[model samples]
Target: MNKELQKLLRQINDKKNEVKSLVNDGKLDKARAAKEELKALQEKFDLLFDLDEEEHEGIEDKVSRGTAKVIGGEKADKKNLVKSFVNIIKAGFLHVEPDEADVKVYKDALTSDATPNDEGQQGIGVTIPEDIRTDIIELRRSSDNLEQYVNVEGVTTKTGTRNIEVDAESTPFDNVDEAADFPEMDEPVFEPIEYKVKKKGGILKMTAELLEDTAANIMAYINKWIAKKTKATRNAMILKVLNTMTVGKEVVVSNLDSLKDIFNEQLDPAVAATSIVITNQSGFNFLDKLKDSDGNYILQKDPTLQTKGKLLFGEYPIVKLSKKTLKSKQILAEDGTTVTGYKHPVFCGDLKEAITLFDRNVLTIDINDKGSGMWEKDLTGIKVRDRFDVQPVDKGAVIKGEITEVVNG
Candidate 1:
């Protein structure tokens, strides 16, 4: 066959293999897309093959004038020619037998300008399908997603300010005598915090060939990757704010009285009632092993709900973070040896009142394959942008406590 016809046939075979692979893998959605592409390629190949045959009509007639026989000994017309070609291709894919007329036409087409293989065999190009699984494996995200603890405020503008009453609790109205002169009272002080949404994103470039040939949903995969990245970014930002907050009280994990003081004396009664303990794995390990004078574990399961897991002091909920997410610090011991210490932050109190996330609530995605550089390189660029800001709101509402090894100097 001519070079163009040969190239078209190769594409058709490749597409067929792709469809079979996707079906075996259980990726039905991608398999459907591949099947559609395969059908278009097959149609194009048929059209090109018909044109090629027409160009060699005289040679074809000479070769098939007597030997070629239709189903009913009828002359092979244009309709039969196309039908026979399609039937041969379908029979090859389905592993079934085609009509005698289709087999005769298929053999004639293969002999017309065909090249010999390495084994000196002609008309031998077939793809065998393989088994594939349907599900995709993905990385697990950090369980201590800090966004769930903090307050999220959606804003339309890029920059804005929020006013918080700083001393609302401290400044209270004084009782006035009946019809007597009112006592002078302190006015509530407000602190204005400014917030500007910061943009974070990245771009992924892929080859045009992979986009067309791959059985997986490339766009969906990219989108899922972006979502994961954005979640990690937000988690880091929230932790940064929480780590920098002023500590209301520091409690030594080994001292049971100090831990009790955190709730009774350090934090307000109302705040302590709705408090939670946030710590890393190492910190949780220490608390989990703590025992009362009775030799019973301090960190007991929630009495109200057994399925709610263990709680701190059987009162406050515990939000255990992974070591990677919470991070650790290097400290010098008294002997001048460096040691890794996980700063298990025990953030007790109302977390929502401590931090606020100003979210623009807009995630923009732009895809470009027509740009000059991209077109020349045959690459498609997928760009994503996420806008949000994390800031401390009521610092006093959350008290920070660190559980770490005693650094002897």
Candidate 2:
């Protein structure tokens, strides 16, 4: 799937250049055709790459929660919340701060579980612990329905879910809006018993321990989030903007091609602008901003937290963000780079220029600016192993050497 997206990217870059060249050459007809073709290709490409919704049919689905905009009623929300909670697992926020004092930094296990068999086995989901939750704040809708979540935790990686309560005399049809709607089952279909996390220590103790691993773990989780969020947020934002733009006429954008190119540009300068500086300077200079009156970074108040689908920034970034949106507005990082918005630094420009700016002169672009990972891109995935699957040699075996001509000094 990725290989195909890369191919589509090449086709897009080629077509974009071709259209520009044709326009200069006075081939209006060809240019128009190219534009139309580009639109079609982009639609197909986005469909392949877009990550707004989880693919329930695949392994990714069991591990991934469908889009963040989970549908709801009484029963629907409960199901969707469970699904979203699963995504939190994949998002790596489920592995909350353990009371392990010896460790300075920790990472969530990236393995996941799917379809538990009768023997207590199933395909692995993302490698989060069996219980990422420490404590659950419970809420109730009625006598039979109850919801649980953690509100003031270090991160907002949890989904609100209603537990379906059952009494000895209650039948499955007791909660249904109308039993005639679906005669699929004769008895109540109770959901599995879900557990809420319990804290291992007091607030202060947990705070101190979580801070120990905050710098490294936060960066890792947030980076993965941008990739995942950008795909989802862009889709939602565009749909929202479209809804706002047309005001109900269902009118497409004034320039559909340009809109897509920008939305699917893969490098949203806006997001890069937010996190680049923060990532580099996260720990020392900017941690204060995330801190509240109690001198704690709001997001790091707990260990089992990750801010979902939102990019957070420091107050100083307000002056830099000249656009309508001010500091800390929910934004997507350009590309899937691990940028710390409030502390680290990011550079955004032309793809060629961005590479030169971000990597400086040290790195070389092997594929040139030929379409990169343009479609069906997997922004976030668990980093279980230290090295990539493509890295052939053993880790320690790889060496870095440079040829140097001996000069008589």
Candidate 3:
């Protein structure tokens, strides 16, 4: 309740509100900077709150008049000391150059000092900065279609791949003639569905001037760039594998009738509960106009799905891809004179049951401040790398349909 404590508490709350506002406005860099300031304020508020409580508690209340006076003065002195410490931290947040200790912490976080490799050469693990890691995570959440449907396995080693077995075909049942030679048993064959982890990343060169700027949120900027690079590379790899998988003759669609048939016939019936439909935006637009005898749109919204837009085709979730990644072919009517629309490959099935991702490592960063290339330019070179691969398994579980883009006659 003291004036000093009340003022500090108000400041802490105000700073917290400011940080929240920045985040809501999508000013992530500014939010990060404000969060640091708010942390300092909260630390100060905690000290003041505890000190005031202590001054009013048992020890101070039971003391004699003169003793009380001395103790109260001591409490005031302690409050002042705490305030001074807070001011020092605030000042450091403002204009102070990073001290030796701060630089050491930064270096330790970016470099690996563990034992060298087999040749006695030091290998860097390159710890990804938290801000960049966060950006990467958000990107994956929003843009990764493979992980949304694929079976992903994580491994600590630098190299590995996944293997899947092809399900054996069903045999025809025959009447038991009481002694008919046991029909020769068919051996199960294994399909080697393999994937190799690949390394993908980029480097950044920062000038000494930029590094020394006390007001810059360099870490945030670096993290954002790294996140973008990884997102692009990772998405491309996923799309490549999705496009490479073969589409069965029965599932290749040419019209709405055929598309519906794929859903009812080609999609593995067992995994229907978890199945999803995927197509490019153009293809989705075509489907959106489909109607039933009652003239109602067949593509309806389902609030229950986990997809971003919660779109649904029948009961299956629909993932409308704005990406221009899939291959397309034009379609014509049976007359051959009339163009119906384009046929874009539509994928429908449980991705987890049909595809696999081999993750060797997600992201790793290394810094070479003393490299000759940087010395001449007074810059530091930061190198980042990631490893992963994707492959399709159980082709029967991933049905590819040609989503026809019908032209209105």
Residue runs of model 1 more than 4 Å from their true location after superposition: 1-143, 176-184, 204-220, 247-251, 303-308, 334-337, 340-343, 368-381, 406-409
Estimate the TM-score of every prediction. Answer: 0.56, 0.18, 0.56
Against the true structure, candidate 2 has what lDDT?
Answer: 0.28
Model 1 residue 65 distance off true place after TM-score fit, in angstroms: 41
Clash-forming residue pairs, model 1: 1-113, 25-132
The Cα error of candidate 3 at residue 125, in Å, is 7.5
Residue-level lDDT tens digits of model 1 in 171-264: 7788988989998777778999889989887766667555543233443455457656777888889888887885445555555666888899
lDDT of 2 by residue, 1-409 (tens): 2346546644664566567657756799999999999888878776775552433234344335642331222223223333433433333322332211100011112111211111321212222222221111111111111010001111111112223323323443434565446445455544332223221110000122332353435334433433333223222332232223223322122222422332334334442332221112222123234444566453322222242211223211211121221112122356645333321211111211111100000100011111234213422222221100000111111111111112232
- 2 against 3, candidate with superior lDDT: 3
Count of clashing pairs, candidate 2: 34
Higher-TM-score candidate of 1 and 2: 1
Q: Write down the TM-score for model 2.
A: 0.18
Per-residue CA lDDT of model 3 for 251-301, tens digit only, reads 656556776676677675676668888777776776777777788887877
Per-model RMSD to reference = 19.0, 28.3, 16.8
